[model samples]
Target: MSRIQFDSVTKRYEADILAVDNFNLDIHDGEFLTLVGPSGSGKSTLLRMLAGLEEITEGEIRIGDTPVNRLPPRKRDIAMVFQNYALYPHLSVRDNMAFGLKRSTDLPAEEINERVREAAELMGIEELLDQKPKHLSGGQRQRVATGRAIVRDPAVFLFDEPLSNLDAKLRKHMRTELQRLQQTFETTTIYVTHDQEEAMTMSDRIAILDTGTLQQVGSPREVYNRPKNTFVAQFIGSPSMNMFVSKLDRSGDRPRFVGDIDLPISERQAESIAARSDADQFLLGVRPEHIHVHETSVEESVRAFVDIIEPLGSNDLLYFELESNIDVTSVIGNSIDIGEDEQGDEEEYKVFIEPESIPQRYENSDDPVYLTFDTEYVHVFDPETGENLSLDQRSTPEAQTESATGAGD
Candidate 1:
């Protein structure tokens, strides 16, 4: 497998529209990287550029040490698996797998047969070798397509939402299988998918794209725990992180979070928040698991009304409406027996906000909710720029340490 690099890549379809922005990334050799984003985010366009299927409007794309901007698709030594299993309907699985090799090289019939058999065995589709694509199930047909790529042993494998055609259960199963195949082959893989769950589970590192620009590129935990901006924070989580607008004001000698509820900020946190010159108002971001029903009074707390409770088998998700009209959710243990609504009556339940749960401030709002966060976990961002002030500080040493630790762990 080879390393791929996109140096300031840009794709403009027309005078007014730009499909991909100035994208720059270094995909390591033999690494499994996923390009994840919503549709029209230019993930597919980027993949096509790498595959030599589309022209690069600007910048350079290199495969291994060679610049492939002028090279045809055949010279790129890459195999692509599309969303639709693009197999000849009349050809059997074995024939489909061998077709590429038959056209590319003048291998003897015996050699082609051996290679096809090996690929089929690797993909666990040996039993379906003689079956035509029309007769095989969706999963089986997908395996056949994968087998086609495997036989060629391309330097890079490009997957364009290959699992989108499968049912949910089948898709999950194939995700594991695909990871295993990549590991066994050690081929540099670039997978494009809109499914966040797929990106989170399969990729060694995820590259999040939005509006043709790279939003964030990191391991799943890094992006989820320490988002680079408001967009990344909101996009990465399931229930989504809760954000509230508040004002930063000084009460006597110390800085305090003044809003629907007033709470004192620690000296360290206050200094850090004050360091950002662009921050006039502050936005608070908290995850569902971090907020809980406060049993005792702490330094920071918010009085909120419980709106709805969703009981998951392992945990319960509590949704609350704050005084600012912003909705926040907390995940509580299912073992705790909070009485359910007998007559479907919604009551005002007091939820607690831990001091550590408060996120960094961005801008002030008229109606605000009182919030607090663990100073260490708080993420600060610039409202106008939509850039994370804490990302560079938190991403460098912490990110490297995390990578090493995760490898061992």
Candidate 2:
């Protein structure tokens, strides 16, 4: 395994279109780094560049200490697993896995058999060694493809949506298998997938790409909890964070988040907001799990009309619409006893947002939902620039603090 580096990498297909723009990253040795983004996000192009399947239009890509810009795929010492199984239908699984080694070297027949047997065992496909690709199941075929890569013992492993074709159940099972395999092999791996869950669950660190630009690169928790901008915030979450426009106002010593509903801020947060000249228009972001429904009175709470309720067994998802027409979703635990008998009927529900839950408030409208967040859980972003304003570009401290506070709360 080796450390991979991309320095100011840019890939342009045409003069006007840029597939990857100024991409720079350092992937640690033996790390499983996942490149996650929607379609047309340049993840595939970036992987192809690393595999030597595509030319680098500009900048450099280094594997270990060697520059591999001019090296061919085979010479780069990298193994790539494509989305399709890409197995030879005529060859048996054992022969398929041995194809690369046989072509590259005239190793003894005994050594080739030993290597292929080891790879099949590692991938738990030893039972299907004699079967051809056409006779194998989808999962078995996938393992055959992986076994082919494993036998190479390359410096780096590259995967491009390797699980996209599997059924949901099988995909989940393979996810666990892949994670375990990575740990066992300890090979430097770069995986590209549009599935956010795959990226979150499988990667040691995730790099989010959008519109040919690297938006955020950090651990899964760091990117999810403290996204660098509104786009990252919305893209990373499943139910997506709730956002609204509100203005910041100073009421005495503390800055108050004034909207359709009014909420007070902490002294430190107030001071922070007060010092910022650009704090006038900030977006308020809160996760679905952070919004709570309280039967009892709270110091800071907003009155919202419950629009719909979706019972999801272990948890109930409550959807509410504020007077401003902004919809907010809250996930209440299954143990919570709420009046579900009045389902499908509009009713007034008391929504309590902790002060920390409220991120920087925007000043676009007065009729804003008074959104409060656990100060530790809040994420502040610039509405105009779409950049995070809470902490530095790296979100270590903020993410740790938020997670600890969230667990305790």
Candidate 3:
């Protein structure tokens, strides 16, 4: 079993700079876990430590029952694919893929050749085996690099931004291919990337790191729907979450957020906020998609004037000015049509209505637009600590289980 464990691992450089602080994680066998964060967040540092390229300043790392803290890179039973592909220009793809096994093991030449051929076939690069790295495209070279690691058949696969060098379309394709390979091979894989979208789409679970500290760990839906903190809420989403600093007014029958504009909360939400904290001030958060726009005034709707509109494919992002210095954005999409499938399943097919076909457009309007917040989708945060106070109140048991932040617990 290739279950990996990191126990209070810490990395410190000169001048007492900590790269990874008390990092702890348990990667189950055959699980795909992605470590994601911004630059200088120590994600790569953790991967290097696991690969035995860096020394641990404190704590231990284990593979199954064996502690591997002192193991050399060659003895760690892990294969790493670097961002640059790291192919030998003079070597043919077959030789490049067979190089590690030839140097590290006593396998016969015939067996090595068979292993290389199998790996090449698995990567769908068998046709390019006779060609050198200099003649291959970027994506082909990436496949060769991955095929090289596959030939090793290690207990763990470590990918350090392996798809970063590919074009956007190619990167998407490669990630999908990699996911299929991991599922087929069932190796405990640890992937590191700065792209949160990649992490969300590809990982079984994601670990968010920042400045040598672990911020959160959860499934994609758990992290997206119920973020643990403000930083995570802003980092994992595409346009990020909109936040407003406001004071809580309890004098009214229902609690209301008072700032440049007033936003009333349901009694249940008020009770949850009161139970979570005693702070009178909070950072109110709502995703752009949750804010709705209407042509006329509705109950609990706020009046706003259009500031800007950005068309993004099927959806248009509308920015509005509610009051001076208070700007909000809402994503509006044309209505979706459900087409009947051959089997008469309406859920099988969905067609998006064309934006130009819509008669009433909110683009660059001078007239006031009424906005309403979906209270069920809203989040309340501690302004000083940045913690999400509403996470536990609304999160389901499955999400809570998938979102537990403790390491090896």
Candidate 4:
């Protein structure tokens, strides 16, 4: 009954501006969903509309069973926590938390105070409730802002990059706290952020937006392991998925992909590619963890030259140039020439590898390297439309896809 539905929602700024376009979604009651993308992706605009702070340009927005398109901000029965922590500078934590209740509800003073005290305690800011906003630390101020929203006990919670102001460690700590609070309250929440890490770590489902369109919506792992397009594939990961636009040509007796680089595919992959071979070119995506990087030559490995090595304690990301993918693109049928880089240069692609798997001599070295990707791990996308061409064969680990299943703690 607490579900929020957006039916063909569109937001336009001017004749030239299309902020949101034809958006449709059903957020289940008690679910935690996140809207994530780069700047100007309409996530914040979408949140503002849900809060009734921004008017809908077209279509309907409903809270449970009620149409809220014409409702004012105060009448929406929703609470929002902003990135800036909009606390009243002159008010103490207790006053800031209780202000909304006094304005919207005629609760007894004893009850208001009790609710304020309860929210303060829940946010671990009770000791600072009597102190002004200027007297509290950044984290404490954030807690106060969230506590203010909590006391409203609204049907829906809207967060607009609320943790963006905190330091890395504190932001991580508060991520857990917010999850715990949602679990305890079981309120439906829609959060907005540009941080894919935050969205992936905290959301029950993530809705990715680009330009003004909703790219895809699914569990973290489903999107990560089986992205719908090139944008989703590239945007959702840390190191970003390695990509190369190449042509797939039927080998004399087998199947393979051709670009600046050439790949002889496995039988299973060959079958999948053959089924979708109507396209002359495809965009290939491989997660960093699935690619094996090495210094010495290995069978079925493509020789490459390392470009960069980023170490992260647990794993190292290896960037290398794929000459075949870059060099042969000019020769692919009807493909636009990508202007040759010098004579031997190619585009760079990255691979995530464990340090133990790297040869010591090649460790941190950008010297010639050999790379191999498993057939089961790579995803194929249509070059023109960016749809997953190999959708049926896309695979993801169970542990990874279940990691962020429903948003509650």
Query: In model 4, what is the error at residue 94, expressed in angstroms?
Result: 0.8
Tens digits of lDDT, candidate 3, 316-385: 6666665443321111112211111234432111112234332245445667777777777778877656
| Per-residue lDDT of model 4, residues 1-409, tens digit only | 7899888898999776989887888899999999998888899999999899888999899999999999899998899999999999989889999999999999999999999999888888889989999988899999999999999999999999999999999999999999989989999999999999999999998998887778778888788887766778878887677767667877667678767445777667767766765677776777778888766788878777766677778887777776455533432343222212234233457788786566555544556788887766778876656667676664455533433232111
RMSD per candidate (Å) reads 9.2, 9.4, 8.7, 5.4
The parts of candidate 3 lying over 4 Å away from their true place are 325-366, 405-409
lDDT of 2 by residue, 1-409 (tens): 3999888898998667889988888888999999998788899999999999999999999999899999998888888888997999889998999998988778998999999999999899999999889998888889999999989888899999999999999999999998998899899999999988899999988888887878777788888887766656766766566665556776577676666345566677656654553646565666677766553446677655545455555565555666653221222222221112224221233233343232222212333333334555556555555655664434567565433312100
lDDT of candidate 3? 0.79
Candidate 1 structure quality by residue, lDDT tens digits, 210-248 = 778777788888888877666677667665665555557
Stretches off by above 4 angstroms in model 4 are: 266-277, 327-347, 356-367, 395-409
- Looking at model 1, which ten-residue stretch has the lowest summed lDDT? 329-338
Give me candidate 4's TM-score against the actual structure.
0.89
User: Lowest lDDT 10-mer window, candidate 4?
Assistant: 335-344
Number of backbone clashes in candidate 1: 14
lDDT of each: 0.73, 0.73, 0.79, 0.80
TM-score of each: 0.83, 0.83, 0.88, 0.89
Runs in model 2 deviating more than 4 A are 274-279, 325-372, 392-409
- Which pairs of residues clash in candidate 4, taking residues 3 or more apart in a chain or in different chains? 260-324, 260-325, 261-324, 261-325
